[model samples]
Target: MSHYKKRLALLLLLLIGFVLVSCGQPATPQTVEKVVTQVVEKVVTQVVEKEVTQVVEKEVTTIVEVQVEPTAGPFLERARTDGLRVGFVQEKPFGYVDDQGNCTGIDIEVTREAAKRLGINEIICVHLAWEGLIPGLLASRIDVIPVGMAIRPERCEVVQFTDPYQAQGIAALVLKENPKNIHGFQDFVDNPNLKLGASIGASELTIAREQFHIPEDRAIGYSEQVQVIDDIVAGRIDAGMYTAPFVNRYIQEQGPDSALERATPFDSPSYFNTGHGFRKDDPEFVQLWNNTLLEMKRDGTIAKIAGEFGYTDADLLGEDAKVENCCSGDNWQNRACLPK
Candidate 1:
């Protein structure tokens, strides 16, 4: 309450006390008349004082509210001041920490370039498992998802994907010596003894289970790409499924004599592609992301970024993987969406 309000209340109490005192005492007729007139004047004055006090209180509150209210800036501007948060699975050839300990990968670089154009300099990378990406976006734990998460009908219903960054395929990561002679999914199905591994929550794992009918006992799932490869090196499984880009980068890093190799004649779907993810309700950010991606696609910036991580022209998605084509079907054909 304002000071004026407090003073009026005090005066009101004083007037009531004076009225009571006058009534209790035996007063002369002139004195009684004077007391009644004084009481009337005091009541009128108190009522006026209350009105003035209320007006003063309202004005004071308005002034304080105006002074404290914040003025929010644009998202990009705010991000530049703070950092742009980008979420990705904790896997290589997408988003991972390298030997130098910088959070980087093909998808990360692709997003970095796009963000740079949009005037967002710092990339705050949030590493998560495959299942956590969408949930993270939903919970506001992260802002953008730049990873190998392909667009599917069910996923489309929740979050919006950008024009695809690339059309990729699956690779059977195997031993360099080719002792198992495992070329593809057929090898695993043909030989009950052979075990296949894939990253958990990956569509490839689902396809191996549901579509390919690979026996559950023969199929192994790991939480991260690193786990799959580590187990593969340890000979826990005959071969593993990985994104072709990941395989390519792995082969480059590990060299010819490395313990792992891509099992070619690996009859895997080549049309499976992926794009950046955004919340459906955030259309403005989604548009800016899509526009940046389209520009990157047109100017060959995405391709250049991909080459640094072992991605070729064949894997690049220009018009083929636009978000418009994502819902046509879940099959990874020429349109590119299905699991390979």
Candidate 2:
């Protein structure tokens, strides 16, 4: 119990009390700091993600706008200036190059009249083989095929065919004095030894095979029908199957001495119906063609051209002639005459 001892004890006791108070305080501030840091990091990440999503959405919208815009109208306008490049297959009265190298035929006349109506001045005609015409159109070598292309469902998958300009049927051409009682496709099928000549790749050949069951071995395929007619005149072939209008034109062009005479046409409605060909993407050009064809049929321009080419009975609105519903509906039966 000295004064110095009491002072030292008092100081020790104060130090111990200070240590106990520090130990008793809570760690709430550290936990709060950690939570605040995590919250800030989450907010920054969300902002970055939202900005990225906005940029991607904008890019997608711009691409969709570009894709949906119309482009065919401008392309067709440019084509008008350069003259619509047209192709034709030399199939005699329908389309052929004359000795003067001029594209002259029923199809040529029709196309000329259409061009005049459409205000198109230049028409560059390129002569192509019958099989090459479709390929030429796809390759952009030609803008239109103004040949007598028969519209079929098979052809529609590849090219967009305009409204039919003319409708016709399959007929057999024989010597005038021949005593064959052939009237329709059934007659040819019933007769066994009859030698039928047809031009290669011609629609008539397909018709004969599909309808008459004409064997490939019995049918002779020539490069051109003129050669087949020549063979028939020389007694090499029995008969030649071709379009009726074309047969008449050939006979007329060769004069009375030509032994070819068209037989009565077969009754199959699908064997007829012909139209011009175009590219699938050329909707504007096709519309122009369709409008021109309608006008020609109404104004008798088509009839006049048909007469010039020896199509005497060229009826634009015949019972079987359906040219209006070409690319419009699900009516496939009559569409043979109105090919799409």
Candidate 3:
């Protein structure tokens, strides 16, 4: 009985030990799987964090770059700057180079002063032919034309003109000893044998042809008004026609020995107004010039300049001189009443 009992107890104890070992093995496998799953989840979380950091860094960099970029506006990019360049034809009393090789004239003085007020230190003066002034402006070879250019309907189609700087009236010049007693356009046209001299590409020529009804052949075009005056003095032409200020300046500068005398203005009501020319799209430059001109007129700067050039009789502007059919003989007396 003792032997049987001992054997059974040993068998039961072995069986219990085996069950316990099996249960322990299954628990070890479950722990290993849980540990592996936790490790994989931790690695995935780290990768996701790295990707999110990279995306945030890129967004921050983009914001910084945008903040560093420059802003565009008028105050920062004013038109009157060192980059601005101006052009003009060498017309006396209006714009021309002085004997010192420096630019000095009414137009030059006005523009220089305006540029100074506008905080522009860089100014380039380019000399251009009178006829090519508009073309050079259109081609961007120059920024502005401050020459004594008149505002005409035909020219307005191409370029922008500032407010009137100086108003003018037309006049005819002839030799003092000449036999012709010219009063107006009728006198010019009535005499078919009379030859008229005018500057090429000048508004005066058009005015003479249209108002006086003179044939194109009888009207000779020269490059300059001085040439017309010279031709008239030399008896190469019967008469020379141009603005009153130019005629007065020529007479005063050359004196009586120049053999030229101004007759009464040809047409009544024919008034010409001179203004600065600019590119069509250059509104900033145009505004600057117009404001300067208005200031000059208000301060008597133009009158002072005209007085220096012996243009005392020359009106700075014509208020009522504009008359239709100014070329007719009936308006001859009316023309003289205009600003001379």
The model with the greatest lDDT is: 1
**Per-residue lDDT of 256 in model 3:** 55
Question: Using TM-score as the measure, what is the rank order of every candidate, best first?
Answer: 2, 1, 3
For residues 1-340, could you state the per-residue lDDT of candidate 2 as single tens digits? 2443444444444444454457783436454344444544565567668888999999999977665523335545666677777798777787788899887888888887787677777778888888989988877777778777767667788888866756666667887865576566666688877777899998777767876688876677899767888888887777888767667677678787866676653444344467778877857778777777877877888888888887755323433444445444544344344444
Q: Please, what are the lDDT tens digits per residue for candidate 1 over residues 201-264? A: 9877887888779977788888888888888889888888977877888887887688888776
lDDT for residue 108 in candidate 2, whole number 0-100: 80
Misplaced by over 4 Å in model 3 are 1-84, 117-122, 130-132, 138-140, 153-158, 167-169, 175-183, 186-239, 243-249, 256-258, 264-272, 280-285, 310-315, 318-340
- State each model's CA lDDT, in order: 0.76, 0.69, 0.65
Candidate 3 C-alpha error for residue 47, in Å:
46
| TM-score-better candidate, 2 vs 3 | 2
TM-score to native of every candidate shown: 0.58, 0.59, 0.52
The true-structure Cα RMSD of candidate 1 reads 9.2
Off by over 4 Å in 2: 1-80, 177-181, 188-239, 268-272, 312-340
Would you give me the overall lDDT of model 3?
0.65
* Residue 242 accuracy (lDDT) in model 2: 77
| Shift in Å, residue 261, candidate 2 | 1.5
* TM-score between candidate 1 and the true structure: 0.58
Clashing residue pairs, backbone N/CA/C < 3 A, model 1: 331-338, 332-338
lDDT of 2: 0.69
Alpha carbon deviation, residue 181, candidate 2 (Å): 5.1
